[model samples]
Target chain A: MILATSLAIAAMFAAGAYLMLKRDLIRLIAGMILIGNAANLFIMASGLRRGAAPILPLDEPTADPLVQAMVLTAIVISFATAALALALVYRVYISHYSVDLSRLSAAEEQQAERDEPMTEDLRESVRDDTDGEASPDGRHAREAAIR
Target chain B: MIAVPIAVLWFGGFVLAVLDGTRKPAAWLSVAVLTSAILSTMALGITVYQDGPMSLAVGGWSLGVGITLRVDMLSIVFALLSQGVLLAALIYEVVNGVGARIYPAVVLFMGLGLTGLVFTGDAFNFYVFFEISMISAYVLVSYGESPRQFRAAFVFITVNLLGSVFFLIGISAIYHTTGFLDMYRIRDQMPLVQENPAILSATIIFVAFSIKLGLFPFHFWLPAVYTGTRPSVAAILSGALANIGTYGLIRFGADIFPRELRQAAPVLIALGTASIIYGAIQALSRHATNEVLAYSAIGQVGYILIALGIGGPAGYAAAVLYTVLNSTNKALLFLSGSLRGWLAGAAFAIGAFSVAGVPPASGFLGKMALFQVGIAEDRPMLVALIFLGGALSFVYMFQLYRRRTAEIEAHGSSPWGAQVVVVMLALVILGIGVWPDPLLNLVERAALSLPEAQVP
Candidate 1:
């Protein structure tokens, strides 16, 4: 039983790691779910036992129920997080038009480049040019402010 | 009374969750709820100090059988710090005009989660509260609805989920080896556990927290999240949310795994030194103010780790003091950095000076405490490292102040009311630095809550 549990955990973790490395956000969430389940299994394995029900009037040895309760709580929490992640990924898709992390980050990088002038020497130019709506620095400042 | 603070936040969160927090009344209501929560936590702190740790076992079960909610001096101190930072940030947002309807609710829920985790004595319960707070943070990270925020949220969620899994694995390993979920019971049974598993779990737990803390090696996600989010959220992330990492490290290391901490002292010191040097160098190169502060946050926690590595009563007390001081300083800087008024400039300067360990700011007290620990241990190398880290911080902070505030043409933007709040926080920090006796006594009491460290 112990051997089987260890092998199962190892397999789940391996698969999770593999999927987590994928570019797609959905795959990443799936990977997280797999890893979360692996942790749940580990909690159960901690108190693995062959026994009667954990209830009153038990005449035989009872399996440790504490770990079961913990695993249940963990599963619920993971489920909620997964839901939130899915929502966030959907939002990302809507805004960036890509679920692939590399693509999304590339878009963000371009945006950051455009906004870079809001920082240094451009600050004085932008502030002074605020009166000139046609000024490129003012345009960048307006874009930066909108964000 | 033990449950009042959490109850207030939870109930307030539920109510605000159903309302439009962008409106004035709802925002003020959230502030009032948080202020009441802070007062309750203060009362609880006094109660714990006078009567020792307050504990309640759920459902009328025996001490070891039921889940426990315990508040000691350490827990209450952290609770107060997190709650206070949250309140300040929340009010800053409210005064600035909340951008989203769910803003007040999410912040309240975060307070509930942080307070619950600090007060819980059960390990699994801690994980549950941790997730509660983390999920709210996920939503909060993307509050601005910008494309940059979306990317930042993705990275933050992915990295933190991985960290959480590692923590869960460590918890399961502890339960398997020690057969207890209650923290006090785990501490008692830890000695019986064999060396290898104990060490493995300890390492796993350390890595998990290191990720949350944005330590030198695992800090890839921190700068993006802090820079992408709005100023108030960044403040909350550094000032309030990051407490979990520091609190978890101290509680698990000094209390549950003292032997392992002792065994890994050299490693802690090495990692800490690397973090300080790396973070300082990175901040020096970053031109953006938030990015500089983000990297500075990473560097500042190294001092906490170094103090923890020193491993004595004075060391633990120093760790606590440094953490509290750093959180306030970061909060003030992040909050004031958004405003353009002269008041905001003065506030930012106070925060900058504090971070560089100058006198008349609370950060000086924190640095002094660490220097005492280093000198008392006769670890001249640690003393030298502290001096070097301080000098680098002074330079970066000076650079940041000169670039951002010196050319302030006029109150550029943001409301004067919001600017006042930032200045008020700076004053509080300056007050603490000038008269640090009360804060010092609080931290010393907190350190005493840990079982006395075994002298090597």
Candidate 2:
């Protein structure tokens, strides 16, 4: 049982880490849940013992009830965090229409660019600064530079 | 009693949660609740200082069996600091007019979490309170619900949730090894634990707090969150939320894992120095006022870590004093930075001076305490680092002040009466700086509460 629990924890944590590294917001939250579960399992496995239930009149060795209680509390906290994360992600989707982290950031950069109070003439001047590096064969690149 | 403030905040928060926080009556009620909570916390501090630490084990269970709530000078000082910041932020928001209905309740809930975290003697209970505060912070971070705030909230929640996981793992490891959930009992058992596991848990716990403090290696999430949020929320985050990092470091490192702390002092000092340099250089280059203050916060926490690395009664006191002074200064700056007018400008200037460690402000006393720590440790390098950090802060702060005052001159001042609130906060910081004796004695007494860190 101990070996199995340890293996499970390792697998869950590895999976969580992998998911967390992904660029999608949904996967990131899934990763959080997985890691949270792994922590909960760790707390439970930390106090494992072959014993009877911890109740009023236990004649045999009892399991560590404290760890069980703590795990339960941790689970509740993680659940709330996940719920909150989902809500925030939904809000993000509403505003940006995307769940991809990289895309979201790119949009934010564009918005920041738009928010800047630059005159069209100043922008043209700045764009002209990069004219030397503009690709000769690429119309898209030239247009982007001109803009 | 220690429970009084927690109870007041908890019940007040519950009652306030149901009412409309945007209404004047509800806002005034929150102010009243916060006032009572602050008074109770002060009373608790007085009682604990006069008598030693006061403790209560829930349900009358024997030692190590039930959850314990303990309040000593250390807890009360942090409690007062956090609550004071919350109160000021709450009033500032109220005076400006609350935009959201849940703002008052959320601030009260945060107060409950901070007070409970400070007063708890149980390890698990600490995590519970920590979560309470973090969850409230998550909501508060998105209070404006703007695109910038949403992105900030996402980053804040994601990074902080990871930190929370690390903290939980450390707590479980400690419990598995020590076989006790009570912090005092764990401290007693810590010396007997194997060095490898103890070190593992200590490292995990340290990383968790360092992430929260926005120390050099773990500070990626701080600047974005601080700059993206509204100013009062920023004040709350910097002033109240960040206290968890300092308090956790002091309590966990100084008390529970003294041996590990001593072993890691060199690493602490190195990381702290990096944080100082990195934060200062970033602040100097940043043009936005809030962004500069955010990076400056990253720099200020380094002083706390450096003091902790210096470890002794004097060093611990220095850490505590610096944490208190820095929280007030940050709150003042973030608050006043949002307001316009001459009074707000003066408040921001005082806050800027405080950060730069000028006299006639509380920040100078904090710097003096750190200087004493460096001298006592006979580390001239540390003294030199402090001097350089101060010089960098002075330059950035001067730039921020000049830009802000110039903006105020161009535009008219802020709404009526808000500047008065900010100037009053500045006066408090200046008052403490001028009359440093009482605050110094309190911090010294708080430091003595920690178990002595054995010198290597």
Chain A TM-score for each candidate, in the given order? Answer: 0.73, 0.70
- Among all windows of 10 consecutive residues in model 2 chain A, the one with the lowest summed lDDT is A116-125
What lDDT score belongs to each candidate, Candidate 1 first?
Answer: 0.90, 0.91
Assess candidate 1 and give its TM-score to the true structure: 0.93
lDDT of 1 at A7: 98
Minimal lDDT window, size 10, model 1 chain B:
B405-414
Candidate 1 lDDT over B1-456, as tens digits, reads 789999999999999999999999999999999999999999988999899998988776887788899999999999999999999999999998999999999999999999999999988888888888898889899988998888888889989998899999998899889888899999999999999999999999999988888887988889899988988999999999999999999999998899899999998999899999999998975667888899999999999999999988999999999999999999999998878878888899999999999989889998999999999999999999999999999988988787786556554766888999999999999999999999999999999898854343
For model 2, residues A7-56, the per-residue Cα lDDT tens digits are: 99989999998999899999999999999999999999888464778997
> TM-score of every model?
0.93, 0.93
Expressed as tens digits, the lDDT of each residue in A1-147 for candidate 1 is 789989999899889988999989999999999999898889888884657668978889998888888888889888988999999999999998889878987886776565344555535544653365656687787787779
* Model 1 pairs whose backbones collide: none
Q: For every model in order, what is the iRMS?
A: 1.7, 2.2
Model 1, residue B181: C-alpha shift (Å): 0.6
The local distance difference test score of model 1 is: 0.90
